[model samples]
Target: MRARNKPWADDYLKEHDEVVVQAPFDNKNKWQDFFGNDQPIHVEIGTGKGQFIVGMAEQFPEVNFIGIEVAKSIIVSAVQKSLDSGQKNIRLINVNAEDLRDLFGENEIDKIYLNFSDPWPKSRHEKRRLTYHTFLEQYQHVLKHDGEIVFKTDNRGLFEYSLVSFSKFGMELDEVLLDLHAYEDPKNVMTEYEEKFSAKGQSIHRCRAHFPHRN
Candidate 1:
C-alpha cells in the first residue's frame, strides 16, 4: 500500500509529539540518558500506527521503548495514538532502519522487534527484506551481546526465508511459532496488522532470534 501524503502530518506530529525524536541524532549509546533512566531499551522497527509498541510501554514500565518508522503520515498516527494512550516509556524516531547503526552504539539496545514488516517478496529485492543478511548485520551492531530479535509476520514466505537467513547468519532461533494466536499467550499484544490478519483467519508466524556476541 502506498503511503498517503498528509500535508498537516508534520504539524500533528509536533503537536502530539512528546515521543517523536527529530533527526540529526547523536545519542549513540546514550539512550538511557534520553529516557532519564537506565532501564533496558527495546526498539520496534516499522512500528505501524504504534499499537504494539505503545501497548508494550504501558505493560512494561521498567523497559524503555523506541518505535522507528520512516513514513511521516504513518508515524504521526503512531505519535497521536501514544499521546492519547498516555504512555511515557516510549519514543518514536522518523528515520530509516538502515541509519540505526549511526544513531545507536553497539550494546545500546537490549532487544528489537519486527512486526509484520514488508516482505520485499521479489528475488531481486531480497536485500530489502528486513531479515536479509545485510540488515541482520546492521541489527547486530546496535544490539547487546545475547540480545534477541522478536519477529512476527503473516507472510509464510518471509518467515521461511527469515528462518534460513538467521541460521546462515549464525543467529540462534530460540523459539518459533507458526501459529501465534493458537499458541495462546494472554500477554500478547496485537498490532493493527496482526489483528486485521488474524481476523481474516491468517496464521501469524513468530520467532525469537538471538545473536551471539562477536568474537
Candidate 2:
C-alpha cells in the first residue's frame, strides 16, 4: 500500500470516516441502501487515488458513483475526496472485486468501469485480470441485463484479449478505440493512471461491452 503523500490526502483523512457495511461478503442486496437513491449506479473496481471517480461524481451529480478498492489506504484518500468535495453521490468501499457479487444483488448495477486495471501479463494470472471471462461472468451476474462495462487500458495485449473475451461471452462491443487519445470522441475522462501513462506516449485503448441476455 502506498502512502497518501498528496496534500489533499491529509484533508481527506481528516474529513471522512470508514464506511461501515453490515456484511459485504454474504449480503448481495444491501447495495441499494448504500446509495439511498433509485438513480443509475456506476462502479469503478480499482479506484486508485480516486481521481476519476471523484471527478465523475463532480461532473454528474445526478448519477451515483461507487468506488471499490482492495487497498484501504487508497480508499481512505477516495473517501476523503468525497468528503472534501461534499459529494453525497459518491461512496467508497474497501473490498476485493472478486467479492462484488456478495455486496451487490443480481442485476443491481447499471454500469461498470474498469480503468487501468492490472494487465496480469502472465498467462497463469489471466484469471485475475478484471477483463478475463471469469471476472466478466461475475460482473454479468451483478450488472443489469442491458448494463455495460466500459474499459480503458494502456496495455494493447490486454485490450485485445478483453475484446475477444467479450465476444466469446456473446456481448456487444461499442466505442472501441484502439488509440483512445487519437480518437476525437468527447466523452473521455482520464484517470490518474491514464494521465501518467498516456503522457509517456503510450496509446490508450478503450471499449464498452454490453451485457447479453439469454434467449
Q: Top lDDT: which candidate number? A: 1
- Candidate 1: residue pairs that collide: none
Q: Write the per-residue lDDT of candidate 1 for residues 73-121, one digit (tens) a residue.
A: 7998789888888878989988876757888898899999999999988
User: TM-scores across all candidates?
Assistant: 0.96, 0.87
Q: Model 2, 213: alpha-carbon shift in Å?
A: 2.2
Cα error, candidate 1, residue 104 (Å) = 0.6
Tens-place lDDT digits, model 2, residues 1-215: 36654556445544553432324555367566656767788988898778899889888888888888876567676775666788778877666756577778888889999998888999999888888878888899889888989999999999999999999988898779989889855757789889998899899999998976845
How does candidate 1 score on lDDT?
Answer: 0.89
Q: Cα lDDT for residue 150, model 2?
A: 95
Off by over 4 Å in 1: none
